[model samples]
Target: MQIVIAEDSVLLRAGLTGLLADAGHDVVAAVGDADALIEVVERHRPDLCVTDVRMPPTHTDDGLRAARQIRERWPEVGILVLSQYVEERYATELLATDTTGLGYLLKDRIADVADFVAAVDRVGSGGTALDPEVVSQLLARSRRRDPLERLSPREREVLGLMAEGRTNTAIARQLVVSDGAVEKHISNIFTKLDLPPTDGDHRRVLAVLRWLEGLEP
Candidate 1:
């Protein structure tokens, strides 16, 4: 996959470039600021962009703003944002629209190269790849009355895993249950959340996103 990277930290930028290159992906451009990121992306039109949440100048949300702009202007390009902290507000904004080809992962997750690479692949293929910590933070900070109150404990577990972009088979393995059981829990979760039936993984993710968005401040 062809990728463009945007990070103000020189060392981290070099690390990310090396990681992607070692994984056999092309690093079309690795830039330091959001403006350069936008320029390079427009010029290269790479398959994916990995960007930090903060960048040069203001050092606050520049990368995220750039990601949002990229989503608006070049909706076909995939975006995966990395952050040192879980900023629920930024995460919400990034996911407010269609979440296809979108991801938000914690920078620490890069330590697990295989998992990070899988996340990149997932986002490039138009799938969600939210950090589990981000999911937890969103759930914990939610101020809205629990729409999720109706779900059983197991069903809520299923929903959390769903929000983390786990497949039914993967969730089953994690929970030590059968795929049929996982599906049943998911079905119950949809009913409890009042989400209409959807056939694809993308729609399932959308349903979870809608549920989470309802809990936002």
Candidate 2:
């Protein structure tokens, strides 16, 4: 896939570009700031934009803000944001709207070349790729006596993995359960959460959003 990278650090940006290129992806442009990111994206219109959360002109959330703009203007292009830590607020805001072709991962995850490349591939293909830490933080901070109380412990586990954008087969492998058993648990989760069935993957995304919503006050 053709890609663009937005990162302030020269080394990290170059590293990301080289890594993706080595993985058989085309790196069309790599820039240092949010403004440049937007310009290049507009010009090149790459398949994906992998960016850092904080970038130049403010050194705050410029990259993230620019990412939002990219989504608004060219929703077809995929967005994969990399952050230094698990910022739940940023995670929530980023995931609040349409999740297709969206991803939020920690910068540390880049160390795992295989997993990072896989995440890029997923998001580039119009799939979600939220970090496990993001899901875990939300799960930990969830208030008591919420709708999620309806879920069993195992069901909750399934839900969390779902939020991390894991497929049924991956979830089964992680939990050491049969794919059939994973399907059963997922069905039970949807029923318990009051989510009507639609397309299977769409329902999974909804179930995850529902779980995230329940974490709210």
Number of the top TM-score candidate: 1
- Global fold similarity of model 2 (TM-score): 0.66
- Return the lDDT, model 1, position 50: 97
* Candidate with the greatest lDDT versus the true structure: 2
Error of 2 at 140 (Å): 3.0
lDDT (Cα, tens digit) per residue for candidate 1, span 1-217? 9999999999999999999999999999999999999999999999999999999868999999999999999999999999998999999889888999999999999999999999999998889999999989887866454667778889878888888889999999999999999999988877766777656555477658865875689
Tens digits of per-residue lDDT, candidate 2, 146-214, equal 667899999999999999999999999999999999999999998887787665557777889988997
Can you give the TM-score per candidate against the true fold?
0.67, 0.66
Worst 10 residues of 1 by lDDT: 198-207
lDDT of each: 0.90, 0.92
Q: Roughly what TM-score does model 1 have, to 2 decimal places?
A: 0.67
Model 2 residue 9 lDDT score: 91
